[model samples]
Target chain A: MAVSQRALEAAGLGGGRGRLERLRQWREQEHVFGYGLILPALVLLTCLVAYPFGMAIYFSLSDYWVGSPGQFVGLTNYREILGNDVFRQTVQNSFVFTGFALTLKTLLGVWLAVLLARDVRFKRVLRGAVLLPWVIPTALSTLGWWWMFDSLYSVVNWTAIRLGLISAPGPNWLGQTNYAMAAVIIVNVWRGLPFFAITVLAGLMSIPREFYEAAEVDGASSRQRFWHVTLPLLKPVLAVVILFSTIFTFSDFNIVQILTRGGPVNTTHLFATLAYQIGLQGGNLGQGAAISLFLFPMLAMVVFLQLRYIRRD
Target chain B: MASAASVRARRLRAALTYANLTPFVFFALFPFYFMFVTSFKRNAELYNLKAVPFWIQTGAITDHYDFLFRRTEFLIWMKNSLIVSVIAMSISLVIAILAGYSLARLRYRGVGSFGTAVFITYLVPPTLLFLPLSQVVNWLGLSDSIWALVVTYPTFLVPFSTWLLMGYFRTVPREVEECALVDGASRLQTLLRIVLPMAVPGVVCAALFGFTLCWNEFIYALTFVSQSGNKTAVVGVTADLIRGDIYYWGSLMAGAVLASVPIVVIYVWFLDYYVSGLTAGAVKG
Candidate 1:
């Protein structure tokens, strides 16, 4: 109200007999206009994100299934999930998957970005092709990988055998537990690398050429320039990309669901896929919600750290 | 002699650069290449492990494409994806434009916190919300309909587009709106006539990104829509084409290729906007 009143005054709606009354009216009008403008988005967010989020929290605390009403149960859902071996395995799997994928994506992304930032023929074409894994839908692309990793018809094994690198067919990529996990991680890395590469390339391109020239004039070697200047300048962008990718990969459902379906004794069940398996498929809404939320605290911390970094920048 | 040495050095560098790039290029494009070639192989060629798997040594066939259109619900899935994406795009665009304008230009209370709220909402991953959202979809009686996606997609889309558009709207000169107001244009009129026209690029960027996000969305579509005919392309192809122990490799690859074509076409055409939109959104956050 105070801000709106000041705005009304700024707009010269303050000039009149009974000026305070006119100011109030104008303030009210501005208030209405502002809220009206934002109402649709606000309402949609409230209904979709906020309400469901609240419901998820509640569902995690109760004994709710799909159709029936849930009764309040204090810490029972969390305790049960913690005690469950499958739940423990899923948590470990998620961390392993996210850690491996993020590390590979960052390393590969930086290498690719540096290469792309160079003057090369067919750079645009290469960049466009690099983005295919990302631009296409994940499930569809993962399906292709699933076929490539198929035990009987795997092209990878065929290539390997044809090249005389292996005497027998390649290992069953998705049949064994460890192999299944590797397959999903490989697909995740493949899908996410383009995002990292493209974003980091954008960051690299924005680095002022004058900075490099100055470093060169000071007799700085290429490694010294990269360590001293490029890394420091690229920190903000790198932080944002890493955090974004971490959150995304941690919550990833598509690759795991489409490729292995968290199979071979539940070895590759990510939190999201596990949640869907338990909560939706098994119809144990309460336990499913609890499993899904196991990573909420970590996500909140990441979000908090990211917001702080954003503010500092 | 010096000139010859420098020329040799340059040639070596060029050769080494291309050699280094070979792995990246192959890693990026091989899956699609495999998918394309596999889509053309006959059932016999597909199952034959003795033949060269990398290329179609035999003639290409359209049997998979024929099966996809004539056998499965691929077309319905495509139509559903288009409808849901378009409607979701329109809704998100309209809401985002207005909210972004308000947050950027309007002097109002709680604007800062409201903007932050929107950003935080963008960070809330769909994994946490999908279960409860499924329940909400059921409650709204939109469980198996495309409308479920149409309404729920904005959960992620609006926040993102609003944040993107807010950044764009802030770059719009304030004087343009002030001039419109000074010329006795109503606020709504100023927004409609002057501000919106100026923000067309931002709007288009937001719309394109929104559409792509909607199209690529998977979990919600999988959870909410159980019926075969109601699935989106991504969900339908993944869920329907693969049966137990018997993968329809040809038809599945065909579906994958076709499902990808629309968004791929748009991405290639507007590659610049898509790249900028992604990086800009990331950098702003």
Candidate 2:
């Protein structure tokens, strides 16, 4: 992250006594230049990011609504939301959605990665195919999933019935609570799977091949090699991916918004979607702000651990 | 006999690998294929419960696409999406290049704190702040316009692009930049003229990802812009197309296909850069 000190000294050694020299003299003060360079980024982020973030906290604490003058209410919004059953359902739904999605993503991701890392033909094409789900926009792709899960023309149910996996007119996917959750989870897993596969593939590619040879030298089976050599070395990458995925999954909005709109008795509402429903559509700015702000503490803990984990390395 | 068995085992493992990958590939791509095929099938075939839903047996037609263009504001939304993505990506890249160079190459006092600030800012998800941001946008008179998206898209884009570019900028040799400095080139001049050229790939990588993010963003675009003409493609397709409970499946799929095609095409061409950006964001941490 630095130019050599010798280079700085060498830069300072240049001699001149004119405007060009003044400019050269200015170059030696590198930190000033660095500060100057970073200012625009700082300004933009402060106004757009930090200010809005601060306002979010302020919003949750006040009795605010869209276009209404909000007055400080000191946790009243939080208390009201805490008493709400729909909000409670939302918290449970978020955890359930995240729990199922992350578990599947991790297991499938590592397996797909190991498979991708193998010496296979058309590797680039295969890798590209696997990564396609992630490249497409979620709102659009989830619409595709929504079409497949349609109550009447549900191809998912159609295939299931044809294959004898379920009975005719199979479960009302978006209309029934359990089926709706499953449909959303399935789409989430479908959308999020490639992210896991590709990232883990990168981690797999980074491991030294000699580790495998060394394991085999000691008479290790392929399973043993994976368990002992690959999985342990992959832990750091896995942890980071999990943490990031947890944050992404917890804060997810588009999938639920498009697929169910937290339908069938709000059985599948995530915090973001709940916040949208309550805050924007319901026009309860304080409650919406509070609902979303609830995610902050948990995610901040994840980010903290993430920073600590990365820093330790 | 042992040599023959070992060869057979190798062949067996090879077959197993593809077999395992088959389902994953299908799971990953079948929805897209479904979307594409559904977009083309005529309404009669699509709604015929007796017909096989997997393929277009009644021959492909562009009627849905024709209806989308003729009846809906699909073209306006796409044009808006393009405008927002281009403007936001360009601004984020410029800011990210400077910030990335600063954090990666400069050893100034408080540089560590600034880096942490960017890191902290990057972790602040848009979901959490969209409510307050909507208020902010209202105050700025950018409500119901693409201008709101253009302004706010950079919040997420800049931190990510800066973080990604920070890792990328670190990989460029310090000697080249230092050499440029020692030769009496100003740091700004050195950065702009010498170091930036070498870091073009990083810039392009950031640009590609930055553009993808802007195009793919939904919540802010959905929350910020309400006008049909100002809605980004993703938001417009979802918010406007499906009226009441009657989803125009064929035309909806068409809208989905049209909205997703540009970014998908871009990603297919630069798959490597895109993956590297993904890894740089997650793995590098």
Q: What fraction of the true interface does each of the listed models get right, in terms of native contacts kept? A: 0.73, 0.82
Q: Tens digit of lDDT per residue, candidate 1, span A127-155?
A: 88888788888888888899999988888
Report the lDDT tens digits of candidate 1 across residue range B25-140: 89988999899999999888889878888888888999999999999999999999999999999989999998988887787788877887888888889988999999999999
TM-score, per-candidate, Cα-based? 0.94, 0.95
* Sequence-dependent TM-score of model 1: 0.94
* Candidate 2: clashing pairs of residues: none
TM-score of chain B of 2: 0.97
Question: Candidate 2: which stretches are off by over 4 Å?
Answer: A1-24, B1-4, B245-247
Across A31-137, the per-residue lDDT of candidate 2 in tens digits comes to: 88889888989999899988987898898999898889689999899889899999999999999999999999999999999999999999999989998888899
State model 1's lDDT.
Answer: 0.89
Candidate 1 off by > 4 Å: A1-31, B1-4, B244-247
Best by TM-score: 2
Query: Could you tell me how far off, in angstroms, the CA of residue B107 lies in candidate 1 after the best superposition?
Result: 2.4
